[model samples]
Target: MATVESVKTKDKKREKYIVTTMKRLFKNKLAIVGLVIVILQIILALFAPFMTAHDPAAQNLANRELPVFSDGHWLGTDNYGRDVWSRIVFGARISLVVGITAVSLGLIGGTILGLLAGYYRKLDAIIMRFVDLLFSFPGILLAMLIIAILGTSLVNVAIAISIWSIPTCARIVRGSVLSIKEKEYIMAMRSMGASDLRIMIRHILPNASAPIIVFATMRMATAILSTAALSYLGLGAQPPTPEWGAMISQGQDFMWSAPHLTIVPGIAIMLTVFAFNVLGDGLRDALDPNMDLQE
Candidate 1:
């Protein structure tokens, strides 16, 4: 039986561990602020319909190109006389959808390839060589090539972004799997007659989740940026649809006359990308508690 003092000491140790983790996170002020901004953006996106008074795509030529503080339009109107603020709120949905879907596709494909390559030395050369070949090209350039072939559609944009993202995800997961597969627990599982698939799925993948999560977080920001680029190039969501990239494309023509049209969407993209990057950094630190200690 444990003594009261022993129990108290154990509780104190647990408390100290939690405090240390929180302290490390709190030290990252940018990360904290980024998290707040991300939350606000998500809230705005989720409740866009309720938050805005006008339909995002509704056109009123009479109200076209109103200034930021205009009577009916707060953030102003665009070339088509649509409310900029309304369009932006609705556009958040497109950005989030493309980012999340593209990342998910990349993560799934990369993880499978990485697991196979890392677990079987025979497969490593073929798999890693292909990944290397992809890495040789600039990511944005590769995405452009894909988009050029696939034509301009939202699904095509997600596919284009996913293709470029796969190599990075594969590399990270392969490294993690190589390290994890050699551990004692994996060896024990193998000795117990676990099949390669079972071990890879259950033991190896679970242990490698930390780095995968970090990669996913960072990849989200990359996906958003890539989607925007695709849209800018006229290879993404078409006009009359409220996408951030499309908004910017339309606003560029009126930049001098109605700077708010361009500035608001630009701010949206900058804040979103910055938020995801900071959040990713914070997650990396949080997930790997021993990283600071080792440093």
Candidate 2:
């Protein structure tokens, strides 16, 4: 009964914390706009087939390169007369999938490595040197190289983005761990005969999670951009995949006479990236201890 009651109390506290965080997040104007846009895209992605008015892949040679609002089409038709709006809606799935998946993988891997590097001084130099090596290449360049070696595909794009993302996450987590591991509570845990892993996982990580989450949101935006760039370069999600970058690539030739094909997808990518960035900034401000006391 006591244990169950204690668990209930903890659950209440967790719920309260979540509620407070959400309230704080929603209070920011830019965050609210970002949240709405993100939610819209997520909904579009989750129900792409049902949401699209016409088949994103179905082509009509007769209707190819139609102007925006031409006939029944809303945005316009692409080079193949595939519905631009449908492709844009469907492309949300690819962008979100690549961004969330790649960043998640990088976050998990980086957090572990960062914790190890930050906790153990003996391991710091080695791990940081490796991170330095990765940083020598920019994110897109690194992803491009990885894709070149791995081949073009959705999974490969995610892997490449993950590889490029790891170093940033690792650096953020390492910095957090370095600061957290030196806290008094950590010393108290060390004095309590607690194992290093236990202390790291239970105490250090929870304290560091705020920054990690903020970084993850920001990294997700970058990952999405990288995925689009790779697709544009013909190294991601082959033909008819409806990936935003590929969509943009396909529309480039019609840019002069019928620019809607490229413009629609380009706008979608820009809006999505902007939304994530705004949300990330808001989260950073909300989660930062220093900002908590400020207006």
Candidate 3:
């Protein structure tokens, strides 16, 4: 009965902590704006098919470069005469998915490497040396190199970005794990004969999660921006895909004739990146243990 009561108490405390964190997060004005922007983008991505009337891929030479607010084309037509609004809406889905998927993959790989390296002193040198090898190269250059070898496709782009993300995440997780593994509770768990895996997963990981969460949030912005950059360089999402980067690439030729084509997607990428970045900043502040929380 006492064990059960203690478990329930812990659960309640966990819930309270979450609520308090959220309350602090909401108190930041910039965080609120970032949250709203991120949510808006998600809504647009989720309902992309219904958000616009015209098909993003369907082209009409007759409607080529139709100016913004023209008849049926709200944001105007691209040089291919595809609806700009439809493309942008659909592009949101691509950006968000690619960002999330790549980050998730990177996080998983990094977490495992970090946990193993931090928990086992023998493995630390080998793993960190490998991480150092990856870190030696500039991130974008490394990604571009990977894409060059993997071929120019969306899947390859995601893979490349995820690979690029691994080193940074591994370093962060390793630092957190090192700090947490030395704590008194962790030492107590070891003395109690708990399995290494159980102790690491149940205790160390949870305590280290605050920094991980912040890194993931900030990394999403980098992922989105990288996706666009690769696509613009003709190393990612192919033409006619309506990807923001590819759209910008396609629109560059018609810059003088129809500047809206490039401007619109440029703004979209900028806003999405900004949203994730400020939200990440807000999360860092909210999660800081040193910060005083208001009642």
lDDT of 2 by residue, 81-179 (tens): 888888888899989988999998999889988999999999999999999999999778888899889888999999988888888888999999999
lDDT of 3: 0.93
Best prediction by TM-score: 3
Task: Report every candidate's CA lDDT.
Answer: 0.88, 0.88, 0.93
TM-score, prediction 3: 0.97
Of the two candidates 1 and 3, the one with more favorable lDDT, higher being better, is 3
Cα-lDDT of candidate 2: 0.88
In model 3, where is the ten-residue run with the lowest total lDDT? 286-295
CA-only RMSD, every prediction: 4.0, 2.3, 1.4
Candidate 3 C-alpha lDDT tens digits along 1-295 = 9979989999998898788789889999998899999999999999998899999999999999999999999899998889999999999999999999899999999999999999999999999999999999999999999998989998999999999999889989999999999999899989999999999899999988998999999999999999999999999999889899999998999899999999999999999999999999999988887776433
Ranking by lDDT: 3, 2, 1
lDDT of 3 at 184: 97
The deviation in Å at residue 203 for candidate 2 is 1.3
Clash count of each predicted structure: 0, 0, 0
- Predicted structure 2, TM vs. truth: 0.93
